[model samples]
Target: MTTKPAIIILSASVLAMASRVASDLGGEVHGFGKRVPDGADVTFDDVAAHLAGLFQERRPMVAVMAAGAVIRLLAPHLGDKLREPPVVALAEDGSAVVPLLGGHHGANVMARRIAGVVNGFAAITTAGDIRFGVALDQPPEGWALANPGSAKEVMADLVAGASARIEGNAPWLAGSSLSLAEDGEIDLITSDAADAAPGRGLLYRPKRLVLGIGCERGCETGEVLALARESLSEAGLSPQAVGLVASIDVKADEAALHHVARYFDCPVRFFDAARLEAETPRLRNPSDIVFAEVGCHGVAEGAALASVGASGELVAAKRKSGRATCAISRAQQPFTESNLPGRSRGRLFVVGIGPGSDGWRSPEVTQMVSRATDLVGYSLYLDLLGPLANGKTRHDFDLGKEEARVRHAMELAGEGRSVALVCSGDAGIYAMATLVFELLDKADGPDGLRDGARRIEIAVSPGISALQAAAARAGAPLGHDFCTISLSDLLTPWEDIKRRVSAAGEGDFVIAFYNPVSKKRRTQLAWARDKLLEHRPVSCPVILAANLGREGETIRVVPLGELDVDDVDMLTVVVVGSSNSSTVKTGDGRTWVYTPRGYARKEGTAMTNTIPGDAA
Candidate 1:
């Protein structure tokens, strides 16, 4: 969604207009079914539900429908304007653009942008935007309003024939239409220091302050945050005036520094030790211990001066708590995200795509993948991403080399790149999550893990595993106790696999078999079937689910005695039900499987024909 907005339309007649707008704005077209156009990105059946869901998910939307319809659809969810995403209502011909909600937040900006693309009219209705050409509540980027409670009052005062004077060097305020005089009754002050406030006025803050932090590895979050607050308070600097939190690159994955950045709602940027060492001459409080540790004369003050450039100097010297250090510097100019140099500490997301289907993919996974700059996975798994992998730099390893791909992903992210180590199904369940941690456990020792690899943050996103998908596609075969076993015996010993299977058989657990068979490994699946028959009856249900959520998918229920190894493959998960499992024939001529969780025993319907065609 960062690249493509969701462009929703109702009919094929409007498809041409939608396509033009989509191309012009770099958005994807989503439409209702049947009437959905051939070139649409996605299609849905229900309009109201789809609109409500998109609003709930906070996806940026441009609906090609009547304003009343969209208003009625989203009016129930209009409480928090700050959290709402831009929702623009476009004319069917792409002529007029109206922002029904989130006008100042982002909708007005998007409306004007779209109108510019199509040479259309963007309806501006907000009084402050229309009269003064600015939203007092929402200032331009790199500027923060210190006293937001005064915005409504100041706007009203200006409307009622009051003149204001700007004391600071704010070009945006000077360019607005507010009445001004040499000495006016209302004061609109803009300064980086908190002490610049007059007796009574609206205080606007330029984001010129930089807070440079250096903390011990694995320090507590509260210690760094408290030191930051105390440093700003002691320096008479507003926290709103801070634009960046600078730190050394080695501590990029440190949680304490990140917590301080989050507290100020500012970005955290990192500098390598060499870069920090360059600013040693400007450091007011240089240290020899730090020089010996990280090859920098100082960390907190050196990073602050390095961030603010040569023209700026540190306003507050090195201030430290027990394990954390803090310093403040005023930049020569307000620093925006674009104007800031350097990169973030990289992140590696160990994601599970849930059987290679977009519909089965979680929203969290989709959002994270969109933010990734690189992807590392198998060729077929990367191909399954479809449109999501369009702009990504993919490093597709062959199916055999799992360790090689993980190593590649870690290295890329260690270089300050956003990387995703893609895996199929749940990454934790017999997948790459364990391998990533195992590598991290013995990192920077012998094998290929560099020292920077330890500085990259790792997050694991869960997905529906093969066993869960098979159980859902068939019935509830895993209602009570369930366990999974991989039969490949490639990395694991066959003796250990046999012991687990025999123990699970004694435990009466419904067994889900993964990696059922391969071309050369066909005997294990047959041996497991024969061994499981020793405990349960031959009539026990066994589900063979192949290609679970992808094309050419198949699900079959057969008896335990009739289990065939030829029908099972790496893509298939074979689930052998327990003794209490039952197979039922519905009136619709379809089959369903269920294992009673003893609810039927208490309800006195254990073996009764309560269902229409359930076998007794």
Candidate 2:
């Protein structure tokens, strides 16, 4: 069904005529002047060479030949390598442009484009023919065909000389719209009736959806959006393709959710939290707090899936503000098995291998690795898991090249293999799990990865992240409300990083910074410290853990004012404690770090009840 454009010339005379027509039609022409005029004995070799030249230059070309004869001559050469050309046969009198090949591959469209220049008519085939309309299958870049069958029907109507009615949510398509003749024998209709005449087409459907979601607490909205996209991708849908956004009632006031809704340029409809809870499919390992507060699984994935009903399915889920937010869209069409992984079902595990150490690696993660058919990760990560990846197919790339690694893993898993994409810490924490869903959301179409019948399961097994381990090793600096930030500007911009640091400092929150500094990126950490100093005291405790849980590891604490930016590198994690965090020196001259229990009064009261001297 894939179409390509090409040009076929039946004879020397026809080739010469086509060259003249191409020039008049505003297309670059080749291959007619070198041969004898009126020569009908043209070989397939000559035709193919000219066609190949056009394709090599990435331009659309048409072949001039009789339909039946051209198919016979080119059938043997019609393998994938032929690079389809727009085939237009002359009818002795050049009245029409016929697109025999690549009807959708730009041949038919190109013919029309050229026909306008040559003052000729293009013979297009498809339904929903309107004087001016865009093909459903051929949406603009960044937009996807939500319904291809409908698109084909519309195009077929157009080719049958019928006109169409066009409607859209926005006026973006007006300028680039195609044209049909005023008297093209087509009618426009607004009704969705099936009995509408050949020329009648309806552009608007009120049932088309737009979903907006919000969450409680501090759940990251970006993560939720990623999950929602995954679900939509699984159903072969797009955010832009939906008419409205359906989200939880609680998120109606969330700034982040509003930001996303604005970006999508859609209306947000909030549903009752109870309704969302009632509709959410029960998961065995639901986060308790999420279920209790949101009356459902609070992940955007669950909410979006529920809001869309069975039609939209689940695309994303994330916990925010003690509640979960999700966005849902109605499924456009039924997906096929070919759209999913080739096998019956497949599993994608986002495993956090744990701060580059086997000892800290969870047993569940080890088992998952051992059971996997393929292992995908950075080369260093793959090397770290070499012992566990003995029999598995390894797909190793470079550090910071996570997108490619995740893509390769998805491709393998799409083929029905049990694949695991590796990450350094908790898979859910700044790891492959989120990226996997993001990629799924942004997939172009339902091409062998949208089948709902095939199981596309993903799970994240928690492993100790550097921040957690570093905090534990350096005492209880993380015993209170805290947050983790990455100083690496690879994904997030520096402005965002600075803003987050400033926010955390103002909130008096402990901050764990990953990717603190590298050879090329030295100033960010210094900038971050200066921002933090705005809200924190000079003597605030800052713990630095370098090569944590690895050979040549170092864990030390320094005052915020004394922190040396030069000492940090990619492998270092910096933990900046709140102003209240302090250091205690033991009699043995070893320094330990601790944050006040905040329950000191209660502890003192307990001591008084037990022993009098202990109270002092």
Candidate 3:
């Protein structure tokens, strides 16, 4: 399950001591209200309750108290929800502030904001946050511990209450950017706009910015920050106004955690692991392992969500990845009373069409397409769904132009237009569902876009992938532990593909191969076979299934060594079995394939009747 970001606020003296505890539990702390002596022990229930209550109301609040008051008033509220406010306790000497709740959820955020007034540490807990000093819940919604080393300076600035000017659509501004100045005396500026007058805080909002991050298996803090810099440079945005950081979740403990937290001076939100399994919206023709597992969808969604305003549209579906797609609203305010119908809200669908045949297309997908005012996809994919796209505005582009298509789709959806992005086979399986989330991650467009975008609703439906169709055609070859691999090398390198294939082979797992061959990519299959031969016997059964649910469908079985590569193409699927596979040729020359259950002998008790009958 994905972990939610949290924050903790407490009084100052207690804050100094509790900071370690909060960080140990992966939280940040803020000290507020009265200050207490150092090393004082306090009960934390009341503070905890108040925070829970605040969260329930979706209101940003933090509890403040002194160290003595913590044990007296705060301790009682721990078990009950206290609106889940950001809680912070201050010390009498004004030396420290401790955040005890909602650390990532804003406790530390509140603490740092206050720290500027009092001149103290925000007391962030996570090792990466403390060392690099980042607030976990700041910006870049999907970045976590993947890069923990880069947060030092960012957190320091926030603690100092340095004036921060926001340039682009800042979701943290709530409804009005101007209101931010009123609430916190912060200034907002444009990317190219001149810096604020001396003594004023500056936040430069560039028209575009990207934060790319790379980390070790558990990424470090500095590396995460370095990657963020790289992405910002690539996107032509200043590092100062980076609104968010985006990265995979597996490295949540690495430098990415601190780097992004400090960079945005905001919380680091984590994406769903299943969602991150895929690639981002801008990526196409991903590597074989990417398609075989989750594709680029999650990365795209994380990027879009982090960059885009809170109110964005999920313009595309997950494609070739478990990752999702999203688009930011370019609008400036809430969308209301627009010329468009349906409450001026947008909608997103992760539609799945079973297999490639039109007959297998789900009714929901067909309905969504028919109701859509616009369509988005690669030219070939759009053409495939042309029948359902009559009268709809089409955002058609080349095979690899995914980002452009997503941007266009979000713009339309934000305008309150219903739209559907087409995907072949299941939208979730190497399809378009994940891209919708990626686009949403960075949706910080105009006011109309923001208002309607936040109102967008998203849904996903199930569909049959090629593996299932191929397996059924080949007589239940997928009944056991099986894995799927795409031979395509668009996004993944051949080295990674080889490793996965080798692992699956060594594990004695059944395998399904998709995109086995294309006109330009022929050697992958041959290479795969050679690798598999290293583990399995020459006589291993290989089922070649072509056009399984479509016309000209054919299923053939051959020995691993005897299989012919020329007979396979992009449309063909190969299911290679383990040593248990066997073929039974019927007397009539027809052949049936089967795998033994491996069941042993059965024993039972029997009663004798002959003796009893003779006696009777």
Candidate 4:
């Protein structure tokens, strides 16, 4: 199942440690302080209020603070232990982990899971867990208890050494520590319902039922809900055993169907008509009306049978109300998100993670990376994702394998997996986004290597490009009309790059040069500098910012005449000023570079302590 992410709340003092802790647990980290670390996925101003909100929403949380502080902040909102989300408190030093609330709902289990990561002690105080090493009330994963209020008395009897008899077939009962007998006073019936006497063992319901629903447009939510309950009741099926609600994709936005799913608190799945129609031979009620209207033989019955796969049997056929129809099917195994029908036809996320700094990375990029099942990028770019890439299948390539990387991402996405193609700076600017489109456009070539590339869903999320970072570092060199040009002749001819540089220089546009120089290509930056000197004065301000927003970063403004090729490298972005660009010295003795944007011509908007006037 696609479980909700845990909320890891951290104080300012332990922001870094908490970020690592959240990444290790694959949870979202929320920081509370004046200046929390950038590693925190969320930041909050009020700790007490936010904690209360999380509690009200029933979101599982791990507060990285003293247990006493967590208790003080959360005590007011605590109610209904059975319905509450797990709240675990950890020491700032990671020495102790305590399950403060919802031990059965998963706080104790979460604490022990985190203890394995942080190498700390899980202070579990539950009596059943301490003695039996299992929660009798909380059924195993994927199993739901029909009536949990009945668990207390049965657990008490078991604790008092009462013998019990297993009445139904279940794999879990075989290995359980329950005192079993052929005929006992306490009967542990594991069937769909409890058929034994009133005061008996628990009714642990396996999630084996799949409810398929179809509704007319604008159907009432109440009618859909009523029909669903009636169908299950008529089939002698327990409503608690329903695991999935499936329908045709055409009904994905149907409010009535979704309302029924919300009532059950189960995921609503949508299958395409093609997938639903494939089960026509197995469908008990193949409707010509449904086939003509929705291009499917059956929606309700077909969706249910499709969800449970070939081994499943339809227990309840289609039952209709005034506006909706419902069906139920039983599966040999419980339905999970992974095995659900109508899987999405892959998505390719072209993400740009900024210049290797955690703080500079965009939140959208982080979210995309977290959701991606496959991460395809260069080795260094993948490393920049750090702990976020822990569970994702990493397809790391060397620096020169751009085509291979793009192809791998597209193929994985074609296979219906969420894939992220990572780029260093902005994916759209001198990055992978353009290459992805180019490959898509050229897929019908002689080699036919990129067939079906156009069908996959693609998205490009912008990031802080190297030129933007350089301009920001140099104090707004890109304030006016400017253009970016890469000097590398790897793809484009050197003669073409030289012409573009000359044209940009002649037009007096502030130019940012990318891929300026390398070990073999040493003189491109110098050659471009000489061309810019023709249009701008020898004393024009030129900002050479290397490794901007990353380690060992440096930003310096030099005269056009004093531009040095030896100091420039492929990693540096050289932002050359226009002829009208001016530099002003700040009080701290650092130079600020900016170009005029004609604000001087307007009234009462003159630039002060900075460069002013239009180039004209």
Q: What is the C-alpha lDDT of each candidate?
A: 0.84, 0.59, 0.52, 0.79
Instruction: Name the candidate, 1 or 2, with the larger lDDT value.
Output: 1
Residue 223 error, candidate 3, Å = 44
Which is the better candidate, 2 or 3, if ranked by lDDT? 2
Candidate 3 lDDT, tens digit per residue, 1-616? 0121223344454465345444443333323223432222222234445444434544443333454554455454455432354556655444676766556555665567656655666666644245334442243232222222333443355455543444455453333222233444444334422233223333423323223232344445555555454444444434444333444443333444555657665333334334444334434322344335434344534434433334443222222211222221121222222211111235555566565455566545655664566777777666655335544677787866766666666666655566676666677777667766766665565422343444355666666777777666666665446788887888778888989998888765678888889899989999989888776677778888886666688888888888778989877888887655566786887555555444111121121221111121
lDDT measured at residue 431 in model 2 versus the true structure, 0 to 100: 80
Q: By descending lDDT, how would the candidates be arranged?
A: 1, 4, 2, 3
Report the lDDT tens digits of candidate 4 across residue range 1-616. 1234445555566766666667676676777635564556555567787788777767778988788998998888877787888899898778899999989888888888888877889999987666556677887665777667788888788778888777666666656676778977676666554233356777767777888889898999999899999998888777777878888876655678768888977777777788899989988888999999999999999999888889998888999888788889888876566666665446799999899776678756876787789999999899877667766899989988898889889878866678999999999998899888878877788744443344566889989999888888888777777999998899999999989998988677889989989989998888998887777778889998887777799998899999999888878889898776789999999899988785322222221333344665
Residues 201-283 of candidate 1 have per-residue lDDT tens digits of: 68888998889999898999999999999999999888889898999989888888888888888888899999999998888
Residue-by-residue lDDT tens digits, candidate 2, 45-114: 3554545444444445555545565456556545542355545544434567776665555556666765
Instruction: Tell me how far the alpha carbon of residue 466 in candidate 2 is from the true structure, in angstroms, after superposition.
Output: 0.6
Off by over 4 Å in 3: 1-343, 379-387, 442-455, 584-616
Best by TM-score: 1
Candidate 2 Cα deviation (angstroms), residue 324: 34
Greater TM-score among 3 and 4 belongs to: 4
Q: Residue 171 in model 3: shift from native, Å?
A: 46
lDDT of 2 at 546: 83
lDDT of 4: 0.79
